[model samples]
Target: MPKIFSLFFLFVLLISCDEDVLPKPKAYLSLEYPKKSYKKLPLKRPYTFNVLKNTTIIDDKNNWLKIKYPTLKASIDITYRPIQNNMKELLTEAEKLVFKHAVKAEQIIPKDFVNTKNRVFGSLYEITGNAASQLQFHVTDSTHHFIKGSLYFYAKPNYDSILPAVAYIKSDILHLIETLEWKKSI
Candidate 1:
């Protein structure tokens, strides 16, 4: 009976000596995506740009493209529109599409891009916060071709959780813009 009592006392002492229970500080996920490699997506589209090596093309019809990154649960949607007599309207709609996210976005940043030699001038938007899309861009020759691309993740829109992927994919987008040239421009 003495031995049993001693064992009980020892167990109680050990359990009670634990450190105070404090809540853990918040930590975002650490996602490491592969370094980007430029590969002309094997599509007969009018423009060609270096994209990530592992990007899987989902659709390449009528100049519309869907690049999928299943591992990252993200996709880039490319929409091509012929500039009818309405470049103004197209720009308005693209800007509207991006601004619509302002309801859920902390802020929307616009960065202008121009490549006069290639005649590829455009604007890229980085929508911060819990928006459905983290990045979007609209590029055109102002007379013939207009393309809008947006990046969306399949998972919930938590920018903090998927920031690593956003930064990595953003580099690829910049590469594409830098290297983009319309067949007509050629």
Candidate 2:
């Protein structure tokens, strides 16, 4: 009986060994984002810009706004400042906010935007890796209006997982910057 059992075990082992063990390839989620449609935000702040029609705008006091993407679990926090001869200081503050995530960011790539016709000038900072904020930007008219915006996710910072959403929103941000206009008063 023991010999028969050993033969059965050996037969099973030989059968299993016929196929080489192979590692399964890693998989990622296949995300499908909606086709974008944009319109001007209906708020009477010091500034105006186009936002994704799918987003919900939450207007806070003092010209601060939260552009929420509930489906995507993200939001762009916007803070508006009236430049009172403090352009240098404001630029420093915006850079500080971007670099604060440097400890967690693998890289920070900055792209500058200058639209002299629209009187808009700014820099967009893209933060790679597991940083808290994936994107940050600051735009100004150099004399009267300045705004700083940051992109944040509601979940834990996993750069790889959130990259698609980041990309989608980044285009929306670019549109906003392109359409950005400042008013003399709100």
Candidate 3:
């Protein structure tokens, strides 16, 4: 009986000689987004752009718009201001709103867009980190029309978790900028 017990203990010890157990790294949600299809924003406004077919446009006073993505629990809030020789002020205000997230943002990257034929010149600012807004942009004809947009998620900012969704919407925004047009000079 003593010999059998020693053999059993040795077998158990050998079997258990393994690497230390480690906790798993965090797992992120595997999100699948719909393919991109866009149509004219079905609303009459001073400015117009192509919006993702999946979104809902909530028109507000002063020609403001909330382009809502219900499935993603996010929206792009857009505000339009007609330029009255106040381009400098409008540009400053837009930059201010983008930089406001700097307190929590790891970085702010600005990309300038210029389409002389469309008279659309703008800057898209991508904020990286757990900021309230992940993206902010401003486009203008530089004389007649000015529009600013900010992307927001309904949930508290979780940079890692929301990064994929942000990238998806960022593409849509780039498309919007590409297709933006003014109905007429104000």
Candidate that would win on lDDT: 2
lDDT of each: 0.89, 0.96, 0.95
- Which residue pairs come into collision in candidate 1? none
Per-residue lDDT of model 1, residues 1-186, tens digit only: 999999999999999989887899998666667766778867777777777888898766678998888899899999988898989999999999999999999999999998999999999999999999999999998889999999999988998888888988888888888988888642
Which ranges in model 3 have alpha carbons more than 4 Å from their true place?
1-28
Q: Per-residue CA lDDT of candidate 3, range 90-130, in tens?
A: 99999999999999999999999999999999999999999
lDDT of 2: 0.96
lDDT of 3 at 171: 98
- Model 1's TM-score against the true structure: 0.83
State in Å the error of residue 110, model 2.
0.1
TM-score of 2: 0.86
Q: What is candidate 2's lDDT per residue for 64-182, written digit by digit as tens?
A: 99999999999999999889989999999999999999999999999999999989999999999999999999999999999999999999999988999999999999999999998
Error of 3 at 34 (Å): 1.5
Better of 2 and 3 by TM-score: 3
lDDT of 3: 0.95
TM-score of each: 0.83, 0.86, 0.87
Tell me the deviation in Å of residue 34 in model 1: 1.3
lDDT of residue 81 for candidate 2: 87
